[model samples]
Structure formats: structure tokens, C-alpha cells
Target chain A: MILVLVETDAQGATLVSREALTFARETAARLGDQPVHAAVVAPLEESMATLVMKQLGEQGVAVVHTADDERLTTYAAAAHAAAVVDAVRAEQARMLVAAGTPRGNEVLAHVATRLEVAMAANVVAVDSVEPLVVTRQVLGGSALEEMRLDDAVAVLSVAGHACDPEPAEVPTAPERLGYTPSVTDQDLVARVARTEVTVVDDTAALTGARVVVGAGRGAGGPDGFKDLLELTELLGGALGVSRVVTSLGWRPHHEQVGQTGSRIAPDLYVPCGISGAIQHWAGCQSAKTILAINTDRDAPMVTKAHYAVIGDLHEIVPAINEELRRRK
Target chain B: MANVLVCVKRVPDTAGEVLLSADGLSVDARHVGYTVSPHEECAVELATQVAEATGGRATVLSVGSEDAVEQLRNALAVGCADGVLVEADADLLGPADVAAAVAGVVREREAGGLSYDLVLLGNDAADTGDFQVPVRLAYALGRPVLTGISTCEVQDDRLLARGDGPDGTEVFELPLPAVVAVMEGGVSPRYPSIPGRMKAKRAPVETVALTAARQGSGRVRLKLPPSQPSSVEILGEGPEAAPAVVDLLTRIGVVGR
Candidate 1:
């Protein structure tokens, strides 16, 4: 069995979890069609359970394991680790995979260390020989390294937001499985603090959008971002911000792209007044096409872009908006 | 309290557009000078804050080459009284092996019977950005962990952290003797002065390297990041086209159905 552990919240399953599940399902299909276990820490209320399975099944995941023990209620890395360890042993897990999000990285790291096994993190793809080989990015996005880890039970953390969660058009009814924690006092030590949760207004979130219009510090601020937003709506996409723009707190972390932030694989990435830094580029490196607008002709970001516009985004953005409107 | 062990690395300034060898894989070390990684600096800052609040000793550690001592001295300047360098030639090893090398250092620390409260690391290396080390090291030490912590505080020996979660910003509090990967801006690392630098230079630095994946893993290929193509398409008019644009807007799915 291939265990694909998912870290979820009221915001639903994270992009990374879904991506990992997708990867796992593909891997399973490759390895003689294996079973995919989608584990989440939640009370198995019928609707909630159905929603979780629906999300996973859409991505080719079918098996479902829910850890509902109150002790497993919150985001306890140790508890999750412990629970996963038991599940792995019980299921005789062939390989363990989770999307490479914050939680996925931490929990898998612990499992790998505890098992004294090697882990491949930030894996873009996996190739198997006598031992399984994984390809992952390093040094932000500048380098790609390949390694074959030789362990019966291996764990991998997939990249976050690598792929948007697309619910399978044909919903698969999830089979509910229960798990009891084999976690010891050591596993239970990390305090899992529960707090009131608030939801993100993703109405404008750029996840999986066909087009993303991004603004940098030079767009000036929210006003420039507003122009970018206007353009996005005109283009049928979402607005994106660079690390600088988000640090200015002009936008939330979700809209921010970088190694330390979200990774967007949009069809088109339009950068405005944003000086592309290596960190920021890592998030959008997977973006299909690039369009940049900057006043500095020699700006590095312009060079990284598929199309560059050397002009003031302030004047330039409104003009593009007008042109798109005129064309309409 | 958690026995936390924080790992940090020294790296050169990456934003300067430094070029690697023609193979384009390894750093053209002659030109670049090393500095404490930004995320690692955050690691030191966050560890110190948590240690101060929890009354635990925040032990700082690193793995690098001889000149890496210079990097260790930087951490000391950040107010980590003591530092250790698992001095190794990390030029060729992949992250899994690097994790093993770091795990050896932590094992030595544990065998020495130092009671750790937790283990922490920058979420990723500033230069390489591989995030496996902390979790690997933590697993080697058999502990739980947290990663990408943006905000952290210690209360009653439990570490409360706020960071980028899957959905949004999620909060987590875990008991001590764990691992954490610090992110950017979590805390401001203090600046080192002439005296701090001088004092750090005098302090003894520990150097250790476990056996790593051997030389010639296969020649690595280096190439510049693929170039993006772009052009500036100047629009016809400004706000006057707002309606025309707004009309196009509904067409694009932004303003209307």
C-alpha cells in the first residue's frame, strides 16, 4: 500500500496534499496499480468525510484513513508522526508520500529520521530502478538533484501548490477507516494548541488560474496592485504579488510567491514593476509563460520573462487595461 | 521543555548574480564570500527567543568547510554563546547524505548526554534551499518537528508557533525536545560588533563530518536558469477606456459573470 498523508484544515486540503496524492496515484498506477490511502485528522462526519474523499478521488486517490482521536485533533507533528508510523506499519506501507508543505516536510522528516531511513524532499518526479529514485529541486530553483534511496519503507514530501486540487468529475464515495494512535509519551509531547480558525477569502486567490497578473513593489503599492487586479479580471485570472509586495503587507501570504511562500504553476505569469528575485522566481518557475512590465529595460526579471515591456507599470498597466477593454 | 537542536548553514550572497562554473552546478567560490543564510539567521534569532522564554539553552550548530568557521563566528555574533561546525566538504553530497552527516553530529551531541530542549533549522538552506536536513536530523534524533514557522513564542515549556499553513496561516504548539524549521522574518538576528566578532573568533569551534555519499556521484550539469521571453505592448488609451476595459473585463471573467 502507498500511504499519501494529507494535512487539512477548515480551508480544505492544502494544494500540496492534493499534489502529493496526484503524484502517489500516478506512482501507484505505475507500480502495478496499488492502493492509495488518503489519511486526514478529522472526525468522520459523513459530509466532511465525503468531501475529503471527493477531493482525493478526483486526483485518483481512493482509500481513506481518518484519525479522529481527540489527541489527534490538532496539528501535532509528533502525534501525526506517531499516527503515520502506526499506519505505515499496519498497512505494510510500501512507500509514504505527502505534499511538500510545511507540515508534510516536518512530519516526514521525523518519520525518516526515526526509521533511520533516507527521504527525498521537494520531489518533482520519481523514477524507480532496483531502488526508487527521486528528482527534486535544490538551491531554490537553480539546481535539480537525483538520488535513489534504498529503504523498504520510504517517505517523500511533495512541493506545495505544485498542482491545483481538481475534484474528480465522477465523485468516488470514500470508505472510512479508523486508526488508534500508537504514539508514546515522547510522541505526545509537542503541544497541539487549538485556536478558533478563520477562513481565507480565496475569491481572488490565483490557485490554478489560467492567467495570473502579478505586481511588484514598483507597481507602487495596493493602488498599482489594484491596476493589476483590474487587468486580471479583464484577463480572467487572479492577482499575484512578489515577496516585496507581500512584505509591504499589500497582500496576504497566499498571493505571495517565492521559496518561502506559494509556488504557482499558472499558464501565464505576468509580472509588473516586480524585480524578479531568485526566491520569487522559484515560486513561479513552473509557470508556463512569462510576461513582464518594468520601467528598467535591463531588469533581470524582464530577461527571465517570455515577453518584456520596458515602461512604467503605473501608466503601462492602465494602458493595457484599456487596450484589452478596447479589443473587447 | 522540548530538547530542540537548531541547525544553521553559512552561504554566500545569492542576489549578487554570481556565476557558477561553466558546468554551472557548483559555485565559482573564488568570487563569492559566505554569510549566514537569511533563513538560518532567522533560525538563530528564533531559537534564542524561544530559549530565553523557555529557559532552555539554544545550542547553535553548522556544517561546512574550513572557512565555514567564519560562518560559525557569525552565529556567535548573533549571541549564540557557543557554536559547532561539522566541517565537511559538502560540494558533492545530496541532501539525504547531508542529513546523515548532520545526524551524526546530533548523535554525538546526544551521546555526550546534553539534554536538548528541541532541534531547529532554517526551513531551507539560503543557498541550496533543500529542506530535508532538519527533519532528517530530527528523525535521526527521534523527535517531532515543525517547519516554516513565521512567529514563535514559548509558554510553559511548550513552543507556540504561527506560520504559513496549507489553507492559510495555521498555529501549532508542540512540547519541547522537537525540531523546527525557521522561515524568513520570524525574528531579527542581532548584528555582531567588533568585540563580538573578536570574541567569537577566540571561541573554540567544533568540526565533524560523518561518512557521506562518496565522490563522483556522476558529473553534475550546470546551466543558467532558462530565460523568459517578454515584450511591452503599450495600450492605446488610459482611464477613458475604463468602460471598454470593464466591458472586456466581464469578457475575461474579472468584473462580471
Candidate 2:
């Protein structure tokens, strides 16, 4: 059986978790029609648990094992990992899968550690099932690597949006069981003490936006972003920055789009005054169209963009904003 | 006083394009230079700060060929006081193997009466993007571990780690003798001073031979993701390009005509 770790929110199932379930279903098909089970490790209310189980059932999960403990009120990597690991053992799972989110990777890493097994992160494709060959993203999604899991149980995480979620052909109510994970005091040591929401919840906006306007060092300073902000608002899009902008404290970390930041798949990516380095390319490579406006035509962003204008962004951006306003 | 150990990997400077070797097992680094990942650079910086605040010694370690000593020395030049190189064929070792080697070293050091109060590593390697070593190493050493932490400080016997969570900035507290996998961007890494470089060049790095069991990522080969060939269309220059840009945006339905 293939066991998947599902992450839940107020909406019951996160998008990436749904995507993971889809990936698992395909993997199961490739493995001679093995059953796919899911484990949710959170302190969910009874009503919420039922809803999550129903959602999982729709995605073709045969059984939904849930582990809810008072100690798991918050996100703790080790505690959650212990629960997932227990589920895998109880079910005699041959493979463990999860979404490649920060929490997902951390929890799965912990499980892999405890089990003394090898884990593949950000896997995108399943090549063969007998030897368990898979392809995964490396160098922050700028490259791909084909790997084989030679462990007793293969542990891996599907990269975000590797496949879209689809409902099962014959959706049936899944069997729900409560699991009790034996966790030690050491497992709770590195848990989240508290969370401070600093920003105005712009993370989703940036990732979900149809258009994203990226700013780089050419923005000069924090004050230089005024025009860009106006342009973003006018275009009904979100603003993103390069790693250097965040390192320089010109923008918040959430606003940065790069290897260590958010990976955006916007329809149109307008990089103003940004030189597209490999790090930044990792985050924006999925964009459908790229339009670069820079002073240097040879800049990586400009050279790689579908459309390029060799000009100072300060002048070009304002002019474009003006044209947009004039059109409106 | 606390003793800190920061582990760094020697990866190709990926600021430029990545090219694969003919065998596809590794990156073709014949032309490209190598550097530690940004996250590890930040880890080295954090280790230095914690050591300074607690009057401790910061040791840098790497598990790779002798050439990896360059990365260890870079960390030493920045702030690390000591260095250790676990000589191994890194390409053959998996995260589990690397974790075992690191755990062995930590145990040996503890037996020698020199224990590390804290161990630091990059959140993920720039080359392989594996996010397992720190957590696996922590488990092998029977220690608590935190991943993707941007900033952290030692407060008495507890370490305070701050990172970005789904809701907001999550703060984590772990006791001493913990492992932290640092993410870059919280703190700026410092440049090496002349004296620091001279001192690092003279610093003796302890070498340990590694016999790895290589139950790892089981990587077979690497291939570049197919990229769309781009032929950039010049849309005029200067502010004169604005109207044409808006026209294209309208054609793409981003802006209605």
C-alpha cells in the first residue's frame, strides 16, 4: 500500500495535499493497483475530521487514519512525523508520500530519520515501479534528477503542482480509524511556541495572481517601489522581489520570489529592472509569458524573456502605467 | 561556554546556468567554481554570532573530497575557529550516509570531552535540494532539530528559532545540544577580513576517513529540464515602448482594449 500524509487547514485539505493524492493514485496504478491510504496528523475537531475524511475518500483513499493529540495543537515536525510513521508501520506501507511544502518536507524528513530510510524530496515523475525509479527537481527546480529508492520503504514528497487533483471514478466513503502515536518528550522540544502574523496575508495573492511584477536591485531602495506598487495595483496583480531585495531589507521575505522564496506560476510575469539569475529563474520558470524591461539588453531576464525593451525601468514603468491609465 | 559546529557543502556556484557532465552523475564543474549554499553561508554567520555571544568556539565541517576544504576554510575565514573534513566520495553518499558520518563525529567528539552545544546546517543543499541531513543527523544524535529557520539565538540553555510559517512568523524554542537548519535572508553573511583569511590558511583541518554505506537518494543521473528556446522581440527602447507594451498586454488579455 502507498500511504500519503495529508496536510489540512480550515478548508479541510490544502491544494498541494490534494495534488499529492492525485500523484499517489497514479503511482498506485503503476504499482499493479496497490491501495492508497492517507493519514492526517492534526488535532482536528470531530466535525472537521469527518469532513477531511470525506474529502480524502473522494480522492480514492481506502482508509483515512487520523491522529489527534492535545500536544499536537500546533505544528510540530517530530510529533506529526511520529504519527505518520506509525500509520505507515501499522498498514505495512511500501511507500510513503507527501506534498513538498516546508512542513511536509520537515515532517517526512523526520519520519525518514526515525525509520533509518532514504527519502526523495520534490519528486515530479514516476519512471518505473518495479525498481521504483523517479524523477525529481534539483537545484531549486532548475534541473531534474532520476533516482531509485533502494530502501525497504520508499519515502518521497511530490513537488507542488506536479499534477492537478482529480476525483476518483467511483467515490466511496472511506473507513476512518483513530491512531495513537507514541511520542516522547524529545519530539515536542522543537515545536512552534507561537506565530506572529506580520504581513497583511499577501502570500496567497502573490502565488495565485495571474500577473506578477518583479522588482530587483534596480528598484534602488524601499522608496523606489512606489511606482511599481501603483503599477501592480493597476494591473490587478501582486508584487514580487529578488533575493537580494529581501537580503537588503528593501522588501519582506514573503515578497521575494527565488530559490528560498515562493515559487510563482503566474500567467504573465513582468520583471521590471530585474536581472534573471538562475536562483530567480527557479521560482518564475513556470510563468506562461515573460516580459522584461531593463537597461541592459544582455541581462539574463531580458535575453530570456519573450519580449524585451532596453530602457530604464523608472521611465518605462511609469510610461506603461500612464498608458494603462490612459486606456482605462 | 558553548561549542558550535556548522556543516557546509561544496556546490557549484549556481548563479549562472547549470551544465551536466557527460556521465550525468554530477554537474560539469570544469569551468564553474564552487561555493557553499546561501543557507549554509547564513548558518556559518549564525554560528559565529552565537559563539561570540556565548564566548564559545565555532567549528566548521564538510563531508566531501579534499577540495571541499575550500568551503571549510571559507567558513573559517569568516568566523569559524576550527575545521573538520570527513573525506568521502560525496556523490556516492546519500543523506542517510552523511547523517551517519556526522553523528559518528559528534559522538566521538563527545567521548573526547569536547561536545558541541549546537549544530547548524543549510536548510537544503543548493545542488541536490535534499532537506533531510539535519533532521536525520539530529535523530541519530538523539537531539532536537529545527528546519527552515531564518534567525536564531542562544538564550541561556534554550535556542530561539524564528521562521516563516503558514500563518505567520513561527518562533521555536529548543534546548541546548540541538540541530538547526538555517535558511538564508534573515541575516547578511559577512565578508572575510585579511587577518581572518591568513589565520584560516594556517588553521589545521582535522581529517577523518569515511566508510559510507551509501543507502542514499539513490540518484541515477541528472538531466536539465527542457527549456523553451527564446527569441526576444525588441519592443522599441525607452519610454517610447510603453504603448506597444500596453498593446501586447491587451492582446494577451491582461489589459482590456
DockQ of predictions, in order shown: 0.33, 0.74
Q: State the fnat of model 2.
A: 0.90
Runs in model 2 lying further than 4 Å from the true structure: A45-51, A199-201, B231-236, B247-257
lDDT of 1 by residue, A282-310 (tens): 77877776767777766777777766666
**Fnat, one value per model:** 0.31, 0.90
Looking at candidate 1 chain A, the ten consecutive residues that score lowest on lDDT are: A195-204
TM-score of every model? 0.80, 0.94
Cand. 2: chain B TM-score: 0.95
For the second chain, the TM-scores of the candidates in order are: 0.80, 0.95
Error of 2 at A263 (Å): 1.4
Best by lDDT: 2
Residue pairs with clashing backbones, model 2: none
